[model samples]
Target: MSNRSRPDSAGSPRGSDEAAQGPGVSAGTAPVGTVLVVLHQARSTPGRIGARLQRRGYGLDVRRPALGEDLPQTLDGHCGVVVFGGPMSANDPHPFLREETVLLERALARSVPTLGVCLGAQLMARALGARVDGHREGVCEIGYYPLEATPAGAALLPWPDHVYHWHSEGFDLPEGAELLATGRTFPHQAFRYGMNGYGLQFHPEVTREMMAAWTERGAHRLTHPGAQPAEAHFSGFDRHDGAVCRWLDAFLDAWLAAAPLK
Candidate 1:
């Protein structure tokens, strides 16, 4: 019943004291002890999440922990972790997938507060042993859609109740994991496991350009046999950039105030 794939990365390994110990890291301008952003693939950057944290005077660390990347070990040095989206499926036969999930598991164990988007979210679910698979119909939903956060999701609010969408696979809420939101197509739009960790099926951090960037790479998914692109009425992202940032800040503060890992 241990909810994790890689137990080794249980929590932030290098404490806040050691956060400044690393050499030649990408070194995002975020202050020391800000937050860690885990990139699943090159495409899935932190998006608005990183922008928000930087403005808040909090340091941001980007790492591909799945690729066995280095530095800023452990949750003690970070305010939180954000896992960005990716084209990869959670079930892919990649050892790095397992390793990434284990890191997420460790974050959960220490209540370090982690956020996973799309594949990032799926991996969170997978690490916790929930179901993660592609759409049988292969109906990969690109573009925007509304997400109705459940009561649980509201608890973590400033949530919009109805938000954006961008994934094909969905998950049944894992045991003790709160189903925070639901999309029309994907029942498991978002969830909160325990108190701090979050798994979101949607992409709240994406900008209009980022969305376009996504479409450029995965454009095939738009016309993928029978897939649906963002509707003509779908508009685009603009306002949510600030909103998601504020929400992320609150999430970090709440997690930190409740669990002091200094």
Candidate 2:
């Protein structure tokens, strides 16, 4: 099922190679490719990341299998795929999620650049043969937190001191995946599973509006054991928003540059 929303018009048409040199597009700096954005729910759409990518001259093909749209069988025409977070567990017995996992596996096998956020990251972990489930340890992570980057993470992208997070479950680092960032509650905060695939446990794509919607909708879950209050997540967003946005811009630029052209 597809959402009524469409890709930003500022971006060139999806998957057009000539878009790289199109008028108003930055010569040589912009990445020319269409990103296949997989949405699990209405609230967990790409948000800020989609806006940033449009400004960077990349088109987005948004799809929602939960709404009846078919998940692409191959990463044949797109340059990359990004799976956004949602409330559902990666292990949920949902047909759409099963299909999403398979699509992620195919994306990696084809060397297409792929990124996963929160539950999306968990899905990637499962696709790569790693374990993902609710936080077994009595602790759940919610709100803003700090991340200590590994040497590999620092070399790959600009690692901010802190990032906005709103997740209760985490995943074990997939086999052969490079550990990029770590947090106190969940050691596996970020990872790179393949040459072009990344998984982030936090919501780097979140904007203030997105956070508001989530906190309002999931207010009941915020009271879960060890879960931080909504205010805790909102109050600190201002302090970290600038740095996180900067890091996201740089990260997306690098990620898109690495995507193999189809």
Best by TM-score: 2
Q: For model 2, what is the alpha-carbon lDDT of residue 257? A: 68
Q: What is the C-alpha lDDT profile of model 1 across 19-106, one tens digit per residue?
A: 2223322455435456787765433446555665555455667887555675354567676777766555688777777777777888
- Tell me the tens digit of each residue's lDDT in model 2 across 32-54: 77789987754345767776766
Q: Estimated TM-score per prediction?
A: 0.75, 0.85
- Distance (Å) between predicted and true CA of 47, model 1? 1.1
Give the range where candidate 1 is weakest over 10 consecutive residues by summed lDDT.
1-10
TM-score result, candidate 2: 0.85
Compare the candidates by lDDT and give the number of the best one.
2
lDDT of each: 0.61, 0.74
